[model samples]
Structures are given as C-alpha cells and as structure tokens.
Target: MTNEMDNQLAGVGGAEPAGAPSRQEDRPAEIAPTAPEPDTASSERGKSSPEQHAEDAARTNDAYSRSFPSLSEGDVVQGVVVHIDREGVLVDVGTKSEGIIRRSELSRDTSIPAEEIVSVGEKIDVYVMEAENQDGNLILSKKRADFEKAWERVQEAKEHNRTITAMVTDRVKGGLVVDLGIRGFVPASHVGTGSMKNNLERYVGQSIPLKVIEVDKERRKVVLSNKLALEEDKAHRKAETVASLVPGQTRRGVVRRLTNYGAFVDLGGIDGLLHISEMSWTRINHPSEVLKEGQEIEVVILKLDLDAGRVSLSLRENQPDPWASVADRYHVGDLVTGVVSRLVPFGAFVRLEGGIEGIIPSSELSTKKGTKSGYGIAVDSEVEAKVVDVRPEERRLVLSLKQARREEEQRRERKDVEAYQTQSGGDELRYTIGDAFRAQQQSEEGTDQEEE
Candidate 1:
C-alpha cells in the first residue's frame, strides 16, 4: 500500500493490509500540493474576509465611542469638606486628589463667619475652575458654586412661575443690587409705586419676596421685580376687600399715609382714602390734625369703585349728627352759654353742648364795643349768646352775642308795663293823668312844633 493509502487506512481504524486498495475506483482526483491558486478565488476570499473584519471593527468602535458630559471653564461642582486648615478648606471631589478652596472664595459676604458657610464633613456645592491643578488636584470654589446654584434657581423660578425670597444687598447706578447670592437687579422705578426716598441700604439683611424677570447664566446676571408680585397680591386682596365692603358698613383701620386731598387708611390688606371733606361735618384746616400715621380709628365705607380700585371712607360717619336732634333741645331766642372754640378772621366759633359748634358772625360778636367786635374775647373763653335762628334742616345756628342784651332789656320793659297795667284799672290809669298833663303842657308851649 502507498503511504497515502496507509494513512487513509489508519484513519479508518480497521485491521486491514496497507497494500490493499479498498475502493480504488471510488477515489476522486485531488489538486497537487504544488499547484497555484486562481486570481478570482483569492480576490473573492480576500474581499469577503475584509468585509467581515470591517463589520466587527465597526461594532467594536461603536462600543467604545460615547458622548462625554460637558463641563465649561467656569462650571462648578459639588463635594464634601473633608479637611480644614490655616490656608483654607480641602474638599473630596471623588477624584484623584482633594480640591483646595481658599478662604476668600468661601463667601462673597465678608461679614459671614467661615464656619457659617461650610463645616467639615458637610457636603456642599462648589465651582470647578480647573478640573485638575498642576498637582492634579481639582480646583473648587464655594462662591462660584453658590452663584451658579442661585442662577439655576432663578431660571427655574422664571419658568415655573415661582416666588423667591432675596435680600437687598446694595445700591447700583439706577437700581438696587439684590443678593440672591447671584446678584440680581431691581430697578428704582420698581421699588414701589408711590415713593421710595428712603435709603436702600436700610433694606439690607431684610428678606423680601421677588419674582424673576430675567436670567443670564452665561453673564451671571439675574433681574428681579417685586412690584409686579406686590401688585398681583394687592390686586387679589383688593378684589376681596371690595367684594366684602359695602356702603355704610363700618370697620376699623389704621392711618397708613396722608396726602393733600385725603388720608389713606389701611383696612387689612387694602387702603381707603378719607378725603378732607369727609373727615368731619365741620370745616377742617388740615387732615393731619385729625388723622395721623399709625393711628387706629373706625371708618365707614362710603363708596367702593371696584373698577377704579378706589374706596371712599369717612371718619365722621360713625358718630350721630348732633344737629339732627338739636331743635328738640333748644329753640330760637333761647339764651345759651358756650365756649369760644376758635376765633377766625370772619367770625368767632362757639362750641355748644354735645360737640355742637356754631359760628357767631363778626357783626354780632360783642355789645360793649361801639361796633360789634371780638377784641375782648379770646379763644376758649366762656360766653353767653342767644340763638337768633336755628335751622336744623340746614344744620346751621345763627347767634347774636351783641343783640341778645338789647332783646333782654326790651323783654324786661314789656313785662314791667304789663304788671303796671294789671295793678291799676283800665280807665283810671296813666291815660287820664297823662292827658291832663299833656293838655297843660301844650297850653304852656302852644304846641312845640308850632313854637319851633
């Protein structure tokens, strides 16, 4: 058997002679060992294998390729304070090395104590100025982190229509700088609708509600407005107050402010004006004399104009009108004693009982003077005056201090004549005596008119 046949017979694992040809007729022709390959088959195998390799390469490349999270130059990161030293604080950033933060960068507010801003073992947010320092440590900052966080919050507030509390820090060119920790701006015009002449510094350290109007994270700017928020709140409360109020309904209020035309009273969340004319039944020289800021008093809702958002109030409405029942107590020609409450250029004001006051005209002030005058009487002096006219319908009282004495004398003379007439009979009275006396006198003078 040939070597090839011997090898094939051994693969069959049968006990057969090597020289025997088991199936020589069934043997197929095979390529020689030194034969060269064809160009087409070689090129086809090369192309097919390369394509398969390219597909595997693409899958491997895709597995390794992914989008990395972006971190800008001024971006900040958060970490925990693991160490505190004389230089500053060291934070563990979960990186290769600890980040060193300077003491100055801990807080923009210089007055704040270092311990208040952060403490050891407390996790906090920080800014990442350098991902790695020369020593391969992450550079972190607390101030920048605070500002970044505040900016994000401001933007969220703007989008979500949320209200934030911020402290007014400083004053700028045309507005105030609010330390939202992000340095927000509030224009001077938006400080208040009325007036804000007060120092803005006084508002420092005070927390106030604010609404975000603008946010610029790139520029690190935030603009806030309190006026809009205040207006909205005021509008809602004003509507409720107007709905609750009705004409003739009285309530207590505090004097909030004053103007030339009236004084504004604070009735809970809303304000109502008590005009100078509505302050009292009598004339008022000024509203301040009767009304002052922070003074509490009862006021009546006279008129409520909701469309205009205005309310008219009166301080005198709660009191009963003394003139309404005045006529029942006194009548015309009645002599009443009162105090001279005030002396004006035109007349003297006399205050009667029950807070009633009447003006005595300048022409009827005094009887002792040749002309009616108030020279001798001063304000607050007690004086007797007679009521010449009492017009309760008009709520007016006309008095005559001078003519009262004359009328009293005339009344006495009439009473004396009536008594004399009643004591003597009618015919035997002074008529007969006077007739005899007059006849003798005429005879003596031959009538005075003829003699003249």
Candidate 2:
C-alpha cells in the first residue's frame, strides 16, 4: 500500500510533454538542496525492500520541494520581532534570514522608539518593502502595513455606516487630527461640539467615536465625523421615541443646548425644540432668560412632524395656563396696574403680571383730552387702569384708563370731606345767613366737579 501511494505521488511530478512549457515557471521555485535520508542507508545495505527505498526517496523529495511562505514586494506577512536596536528592528518572517525594518519603517509616528512600538519575541504584521534588498535580506515596514489595513477598514466602515473609535492626536488647520491607525481628519463642523469657533485642543488624546464620511485610497485621505455619527444614533432613538410619543404627553428632559430661538431638550433618547414663545405665557426675547443648559425640567409634547423629524415641546404647557383662570383674577370695574407694553394707533397694550394683557382704547384713555390717561405714555411705563371687559375665550382684556382716573379722584374728594367733618365735632356743617353764601358756592362746586 505504501509503494502504491508513492507511485501515485510520482505520477503527479512526472515529466511533462517534451515540448510543453516548464511546470515550475508559474509556481515558486524551491532552492533548498535535497540530502539523503537515514532510511536510504538501510536500502543501500540490501536489507530493505522496494517500499523502504520508495520511502527514503519520498523523504528526500519532500525536503527538496518544501518552500518558505511566498512573499512579494507589496505583500503583508506576519513576523516575530527578533531584535530591537537604534538602527532598526529585526523580524523573522518565515524566511532563510531575519528581515530588516529600518527606523522610518517601524511606526507611522517616527518619534516612537522601536522598542516602544514593538518588543523582542512579539509577533506583528509587516509590509514587504522589497522581498530581497541588495543584502538579500527582506525589507519590511510596519507603517505601510498598518496604513494598508486602516484604509481597508475605513472603506468597509464607510460602506456599511459603521462607527469606529479614533484617538485625537493633534489640532490642525481646519479641524482635529486623529489616529485611526492611519491619520484621519475630523473637520470643525463635524467634531460634534456644535460650534466651529470652539477650541479643539480639549479633544486631543481622547478616544471618540467617529463615522467615516469619505475615503480615498489613491490620495490616502480619510474624513470622519463625530457629529454625523451622533446624529445617526439619535435618529434611530428618535424614531423609537416618536413611535411612543403622543401629543399632550409629559416627558422629563434635560436642557442640552440653547439658541436664540429656543432650547433643545433631550428627552431620554431624543431632542425636542422648546421654542421661546412656548416657554412661558409672558413673552421672552431669548430662551436663556428662562432656561439654562444642563437644567432638568418637565416638558409637554405639543406636536411631531415625522417627515422632518421635528418635535415641538412646551415648558409652559406643563405648568398652569395663565389664561385658564384669567376671569377669576380680573373683573369688570376692577382697577389694575400694569406696564405699557406697546402703543398702537387705536390703543395702548398693557401687560399685567402673569402675562395678562389688556387694551386701552384711544377714547377711553382719558376722562378729558388733558387727563393723565391721555395717550402719550411711553412703552414700558407703569399705568393704573380699570378692567372694563374680560374675554377669557378670546384671551382678550379691555381696560379703561379714564374710569380708573375718575374713581381715584372721587375717593380723594370723599377723604377730604370726611376730614372736614371730623374736625367739626363729627357733625355736618350747618347752613346759616353767613353759611348760606358758602352753601350755594359748595353746590356749584359739586355740580362742576360732577360734570368734569
């Protein structure tokens, strides 16, 4: 059986046709010399059979045909670091002799010591710079090998929209430089800091998640974005939140960021816009006036625009509605004080506490043309007025400045008359011959005051 197996193997390596091309040309040429095996001595002594001779011959053939792992100029292969010195690193790559990795080829970061980059007896992958240099030793580069591998990984991540971690290395002209095994750039707008003017130095040495936005093997360029990665993750979370969200539902949120128009609130997994107008019943110029970043608060969901992935939230909605109890606070003929918010051709709008506003018509502004309620008051000035009408349904209030002034004047007159009686022994003034003249003058004063 052993002799038959030997014959079968011999047939495979048998001589090709006389005119055919050399069979070894397309394959690796083995250079190791064949030597006689110990078993061949037994055959030569005439004590062994044909099977023993075939076995000896087969053993010699195996030695001659065996080859080292084939390597080329651009191939990457695993090797063990045999030595680390100031000159370079010696790596054994399954070769006749160890390969020579020069100082520049040790790592992408040239400043790193070879020993720091690699240690003796540690195995690493290296690029074949030249299979055989002038010295017949393999020229290898760890830098190039890492670069090639990084490009492949980046391309795959970009294609599949995968997130990868990169260590921030340095701050560059328009962005931050990161080590993604290869040098990668994260643009200022893509750093996820929300502003391009922010300092990027803080991110140095930090490992952050990134999404590859662009990759070019020819140029050896890679562009990544931490912002896009975060947004994409938020999108999925928002989709889930949107599924469970209902209008008028309450949610606990953190104030993530503030803008002139609104504050962005992070509600568990999603961010919702809390518009300035909806922050309070009273008007505010900016969201920061009421909310600060990192503040936690409860918010009400007002509306969701799924196509745009927009969420409308309200902080004021979660609280009591000032208008809901407007009638209970202000009644017709009740005197109130407020700031003059603005003036229009028809009237001036006054804003009371709790954000209630009432309009004073031009006609009702003054008891007469020269009265204090006349429409010349500057905006934001304090004014006293009487609530003439309250319309909670329309969220409108009608006030009369003239009535408030008239009532004030009448109260002062009554106080003066009561004081005079108190000084006169608590009895009403008597009309006499001398008093008749005073009585008639008083009657005329009363009529004129009433007419005014």
Task: Provide TM-scores for the models.
Answer: 0.57, 0.54
Tens-digit lDDT track for model 2 on 145-220?
9888888899999999999999999999899999988889999999875586777898998998899999987887
Candidate 1 per-residue lDDT, tens place, 266-293, comes to 8877899899988877666689878888
lDDT of 1 at 103: 85
Candidate 2 off by > 4 Å: 1-160, 187-208, 213-231, 234-238, 251-277, 285-299, 304-313, 369-376, 424-452
Off by over 4 Å in 1: 1-87, 90-101, 119-123, 128-139, 160-165, 194-211, 251-261, 266-271, 281-283, 293-298, 318-348, 352-355, 359-400, 403-452
Superposed on all Cα atoms, model 1 deviates from the true structure by an RMSD in Å of 13.0
Question: Total clashing residue pairs per candidate?
Answer: 3, 0
Model 2 error, position 410 (Å): 1.8
Model 1 residue 202 CA deviation (Å) reads: 6.3
Worst 10 residues of 1 by lDDT: 443-452
